[model samples]
Target chain A: MTDQPWIAVDAMGGDEGLEVMLAGVARARRRFEGLHFYLVGDEARIRAGLHSHPNLSANSEIVHAPEVVGSSEKPSQAIRRSKVTSMGIAIDLVKQGRAAAMVSSGNTGALMAMAKLSLRMLPGIDRPALAAPLPTLGDNDVVMLDLGANTEVDARNLVQFAVMGAAYARVILDLDRPRVALLNIGSEDQKGTDWIREAAAELRAATHLPLDFTGFVEGDKLARGHVDVIVCDGFAGNIALKTAEGTARFVGDLLKRAFTSSVRSKLGFLISRPATQLLRDHLDPNNHNGAVFLGLKGIVMKSHGGANELGVATAIANAAKMARADLTRRIAEDLGLEHVA
Target chain B: MTDQPWIAVDAMGGDEGLEVMLAGVARARRRFEGLHFYLVGDEARIRAGLHSHPNLSANSEIVHAPEVVGSSEKPSQAIRRSKVTSMGIAIDLVKQGRAAAMVSSGNTGALMAMAKLSLRMLPGIDRPALAAPLPTLGDNDVVMLDLGANTEVDARNLVQFAVMGAAYARVILDLDRPRVALLNIGSEDQKGTDWIREAAAELRAATHLPLDFTGFVEGDKLARGHVDVIVCDGFAGNIALKTAEGTARFVGDLLKRAFTSSVRSKLGFLISRPATQLLRDHLDPNNHNGAVFLGLKGIVMKSHGGANELGVATAIANAAKMARADLTRRIAEDLGLEHVA
Candidate 1:
């Protein structure tokens, strides 16, 4: 029985099963020495996979679960199987104080549903927002929130998201005051919906919060690195985030086509491989895999279903970092301050 | 006086004023022989600028305007000065049938306001949509619509956008039955708002339209080339378009930095300049510059304010193409068919 913080892992959640998940845990364990894992899944399969990762097996505890949540299963259906399913039990471990956080690569709708139902929201937060760090041209990656959590949000929901997002950014980016802005079509005061305008007015009035309200930012300026935290309703945020990803991949595909156009170009690509490799590393989705569900009572990190071992490990590391930083407590304190203000 | 189609040019609208706009028109005129221009701006400056382009000066006639709409001016304010301003007069030329189309690189809000006020919406259309062609991995560019034209739209508006967007795509992409889709957070039927779901239901029911409704698409797949037209509310469309542009530019910047990082990379860049130039041309916004205000009684094109000569010419060319294809009539006919269905 170690006193080290434990992160519950839904071992059977992702597209790749026990072997890849265990390998990812092993890799994460090497990077984070003080973290232990609650490997919740089929005990027999997990135990068999553990033979390959001796170091991880020594630090992990297996809990058997008979059912696995289907990737296409509805959240409502998945929630009914909370007691028997691996994903549900892993989340339960966090609720029971056996684990500090939970990470899953299962159906996003299911995870969000279960987490929201089981953990519930923080005192000031009406809803939990999905926050992720996107690569930017500045010194730090920008934190964006509500990436499909609440498709529709009012002014109050947006203000709470801002407080929660700013607190999360402060812990993750190590900044005292993160610059937050609403995502809109234009930067003008009269831009966007009444909800966005109202939220901006509230944020502007919140001078005592640990964030600098930078008014509004458009989608094209998202990766320009002008603002630290970009907030919007889930519909817009999800659209912007996914569009950026698609564009990045589109450019990469074009580069490949360009480099392979001729033999001379191929030679140039070879010579420029080191430099291009650096750019590739910067743009790789695996390097920035984890997306945290902010404003929840307990931490829940989502790993991309198609992510490889490195991506999964990155997600685990992110969960451990948030737990170590006491992000939930920090957010609660921020919300309290906001309430007082 | 000539029988050639005349495109009204807002000579004083863009950032560079007369020089860039005239140069762009001259370039476009060289490519399109059967085109004339109504150069609307300060008569003295346009005459002086056109002296350098003898060919354009021979084909174009100057329509003097006393005022230039300020880039930061509100739409309501700009709409009042429609009788005197360059952008307003250019739109007026279209409304009066003196010009086949109008091209401006001025304030987007001002242009949209003036065009809508002057030209009015086509029959069976409630609102005009801003449609633009985006580069894709496929042989043809994909058309996206309602890019900041209407911030909030109902199911009827979305369905209207789909019909108009498909008509525009058929003209622009030269396709028989352009595959159309509604942009949402997810492809699942139950994923988005009620409006989106209702719009999807309507589109799925309409089989008599010229477009092939392919169901829903996400932001990340906007440029994937599977669908010909993507329809969304102006807010989401604008965010997706701008984010795509920003990400492309971000990647380009990173590529530049990568190529200049090492001595070997610098040499490689010199050798691969041709290939990279090809990529640059493909990604350049100028190549895809023109955005048309669809469902309008007259053709109106909006150019990027900061676009160079090539960009403005592309906008002019796009306007000319739309005018020649009789895009407005096509959309009107599509809408009538939709109404009947």
Candidate 2:
């Protein structure tokens, strides 16, 4: 870990183009001191966007890229045809050891495909899982993984996810022994399929790992603010994550409608604005934007494509924290592989 | 459709005892007139419970069931030893043609195992899928299925689940052309794995069905009120259902905390009491208690084990509605089998 970590930012990625990305970089620079950035994009446009942020331009050096990856572009097409796209160039810089970490908000599949191929997986990891921090009720957010990385995982893969997840939680949650739980419909041992049960057995036997393997936790327990890491295959993880988001949004919408239906309720909503703002901050997706692709040799943070400037800044800060913590080395040591760095 | 539908009630199935079951029966009888119930439990306890429900007693008869399956008992163990248990006997009544449908709030796994073995599957059905009505934004609820029935299903089973879910939705939601969609992380064609894609292809090919195949729907669209039926394998379905419930409760808890934080907010809560009531009624588990096991020879609704009297009554009313609508016959006809009513 270094005091000054340089992060590669794909200036042309995300729903918004260079301006939003550069503004976020400026904001993040103010948040985290002694940080440098490799701004990968068209040099002219990068300079034009940086006109608003004198501090960001002083800290960032532009790496010229002629092409950009479209949001709808297929992973294979992006990899094969547009090798010089900002997303691809940023990922390449991480592989070349010029950047400690990379952040991109491009097409998810395309970014994942490019990152996995460019940096490659860690020696012992068969596949890298998409790890995201979910907002729980407690002070520290819970880390959930395989959030649409590999839809189908076998027993060995699940055990590996457990190991990787524990290591990631140790860095992000700053806990010596994070309580890990497998997500299931029921908490009983005999519940769920054979694969999950087999993984539990394997995890139980692997006493060398530094995690408390509390048996099975249901989907309802995911937001209860207790468990540190909730493990599941990408299929269930994606469903649970999206469903919780949808339901929250639905409730938020319902509250808005209810409050605006009449004059008394409308004034009540105004009176309770502070309390509602606290609730909004707690449930806001921007506060928990960055989702990292774990198990790769080099760290790659994925910001949500439609995230705002603050969200992009949040993702960049997360990337810097994970990089400074040497998350990759932590995972390598936990898997009993020789530490890459 | 029968005017006088006789349903079997498992008096000792739920977390609450016979008193709660009988009280629910009383409430359900008030909701649906000319409905008869055959209460299956211990004779002494049944009579004691019936003492409070004079109206239900007038329309109900007790069938003595000596044994009771413990909540923690395995399905295989319960089947081998407890044939005369309240849950088992209620299902047996449906099998013997003494009851039109059965309602139980017992061990879900044990109930499923016993019901499948006793009443058997429908003619063209390979296996049974658990179908439940989920609250949506419109006047009607959306029906989602394969909720913990078959954890791992093939393309063929997913197609079957689609057929069953559409039929269930048709009767429950009362829509002529129920919009059915396969549940996936994304609505795109190449979003999920092989099974889901294959199932989508098959559903698209089968234009003979009465449903409007609306491609794929994401988890967020489950409560949007437009899609009539959402189909997925049991594992994903279970997680989605529980996650939605958990998120709704999470929001409700947050609202409570927000409203009670200070004097001004608490007074605002009082002024907006009517609006909060609406939200409460919308998110109440008691208002949405019935989850029916579809593709069986007879209708079987599984209520939550810890459901209160209101939840139990909701389940009974749902069973009566299904029985009158001849839900099994509708499903059989859709699958190209002879309608069994």
- lDDT of the candidates, in the order given: 0.92, 0.88
lDDT of 1 by residue, A1-341 (tens): 23368999999998977777888889999988888999999999999889898998678899899999999899999999989999999999989988999999888889989999999988978888999999999999999998988899999999999999999999999999999999999999999999999999999999999999999999999998899999999999999999999999999999999999999999999999999999999999989998999988999999988788888999999999999889999999999999998
Per-residue accuracy of model 2 over A107-176 as CA lDDT, tens digit each:
8888889999899998778888998998876778889988888899998888888888989999988999
Candidate 1's docking class is: high
lDDT of 1 at A40: 90
Interface RMSD of 1: 0.7
Give candidate 1 misplaced runs (Cα > 4 Å).
A1-3, B1-3
Candidate 2: tens digits of C-alpha lDDT, residues B127-183? 899888888777788889988988899998998899889888888788888899999
Q: After superposition, how far is residue A202 of candidate 2 from its true place, in Å?
A: 0.8
Query: Pick by DockQ: which candidate is best?
Result: 1
Supply the TM-score of chain A against the true chain A for every candidate structure.
Answer: 0.98, 0.97
Question: Model 2 — TM-score against the truth?
Answer: 0.97
What docking tier does model 2 reach? medium
lDDT of 1 by residue, B1-341 (tens): 23378999999997877899999999999999999999999999898988889998678999999999999999999999999999999999998999999999999999998999999989888888999999999988999999998999999999999999999988888999999999999988898999999999999999999989999999889888999999999999999999999999999999999999999999898888899999999999999998998988999999999989999999999999888888888888888999888
